[model samples]
Target: MTHSRKILVTGADGFIGSHLTEALVRQGHDVKAFVLYNSFNTWGWLDQCAADIRGHFEVFSGDIRDPYGVRKAMEDCDRVLHLAALIAIPYSYHSPDTYVDTNIKGTLNVLQAARDLGVSKLVHTSTSEVYGTARYVPIDEKHPLQGQSPYSASKIGADQMALSFYRSFETPVSIIRPFNTYGPRQSARAIIPTVITQIASGKESIQLGSLHPTRDFNYIEDTVRGFIAMLESSNSIGEEINIGSNYEINIGDTVSMIAELMNRSVNIVSSDDRKRPEKSEVERLWADHSKAKNLLGWEPLYSGTEGLRKGLEKTIEWFTKPENLSRYKADLYNI
Candidate 1:
């Protein structure tokens, strides 16, 4: 099932995308990283990738919203992993139009190029946020997608657009729905990094939003492995698979565990600015990854509460480093 491929990973500049790009390069695949265009000529996290993979892969700077740029970056690439999108929920509140253009139309650009170029496979990234509040425990692919926030709604549009190509043009598209991936190089906007950065900054009291909501967190390594597994499996064509640790923990308990791991006695303070609107908040998410295991022969190595602790230990260790901790503004709330 393993073979050399010319792969293009859009949004390769971001957290998960950078890890995935490095993983692909180390696996001996020809990698083209399509990072967002910026005036500063920055490549997001890829600008700071490990020295071993510093020049191992190609970087294509462009905007996913541009069809011409997308097509150009995807040229001659056999596989495409679409990860670029407007992901911040709070920013989406007042700027929903940007989400539509980036998440929905941006995805359309990838689908169009994949269809026109006749790529071998296309893996579209989907978030657990699409499932919303989880109508039932251990949500699976069949669970109805509810776009509680503009970010989630846009992703739902993107997912349907990808699926539409498969049904209409028979594009080899596979959707990978990853639940709350966390680890090193993560943005402080996310809860895990938020807590780690705050505590690492010598804060006795942590500012958070809702502590009652629960999430199924997967380590970055596991999430990257899931993407590779999805790419390798022929059965993934036209299928949507969930990549998760299958372990649920409330935000409060997760913070407590992180504090214990860091050996810090910290107080959690609820911040209104960080909390989502009453209707927009995704209260719970618990993944049933049996489909991924049955289809792609993939499952999270970090698969339970014990696994979560191990993952957090590593995350804390990384974030506590002086060089890494200095990059984040722990005092500021990321909206």
Candidate 2:
């Protein structure tokens, strides 16, 4: 928040990118938002953000897979936060080539552009999925990465490409690996939104997949702050830092918690269509955020119940709005 530099955010139209872009504008930074090009001239989540924040952003339409477009977007920017990628795990199973093209090759475009443009810092977004199932309690940076799904495999490829640029060309890069982030504007393909949408749409019985897997869910606001804090810390360059609440809860318990927060109870049914293939599912993920704290002075500000309440409130508010809930087909399985 100190120096107001030109920050380029790829995937500014998506959930996390849109929030990060808005956060940057609120912090008084000049932002250039790179959104995917389309014939409709759609801005995605950027369309829903405040006018003042949108006014501060310079919107450009282009594809991240195009190196030329990526470089053009980075021009005159002091830093870059790469968030564009194919994020749906189930979709990746069908079109893995696209995931590799976007996540891995698209990341290559960003890193190459940053190195060529001499950007001050590049904050690359990573996911906890890269660790697969947790091998030990509080998974840390040193934990072995297991690519259990095509989505995770592509992310692993992307992370390595960014790190290689750091080690080889000395491009200033920090991998901001955030655990599961949920909040308003999230798509129904994700768990929290799926649950909230079902309840909002008046479903008597909630259909879910495997409910045993546990995840460390960070509220979107804290995740955004973690990105800024990581970039602000000079010591974070060339380091991979986790941004997550240390606490985690199982999916079944999370459903109960959400129901409790909403003051509604419903029977939960396991749906075969919602479940992941046995080999592709990640059983557990818990974050060891000690590195982030010791190095970048970062820690999650929201605990589970607090974060869940905030997320569920916003999600319920959004879904209850006729226009917003219409985007999701709650009667059918998203995967």
Candidate 2 lDDT, 1-335, residue by residue in tens: 23237899999999999999999999888899999999999988998897878678899899999999999888888888889988999899899999999999999999998888889999999999999999998999999999999999999999999999999999999999999998878888899888888987889899999999999998898899999998788899999988888888999998887787778898999988888899889999999999999998887778666766676677677677888888889888786
Predicted structure with the largest lDDT when compared to the true one: 1
* Model 1: residues with Cα > 4 Å off, grouped in runs: 1-4
Candidate 2 whole-model C-alpha lDDT, 0 to 1: 0.89
| TM-score of every prediction relative to native | 0.98, 0.96
Model 1: lDDT of residue 13: 98
For candidate 1, give the lDDT: 0.94
How far residue 325's Cα lies from its native spot in candidate 1, in Å, is 0.7
Residue 170, candidate 2: C-alpha displacement in angstroms? 0.3
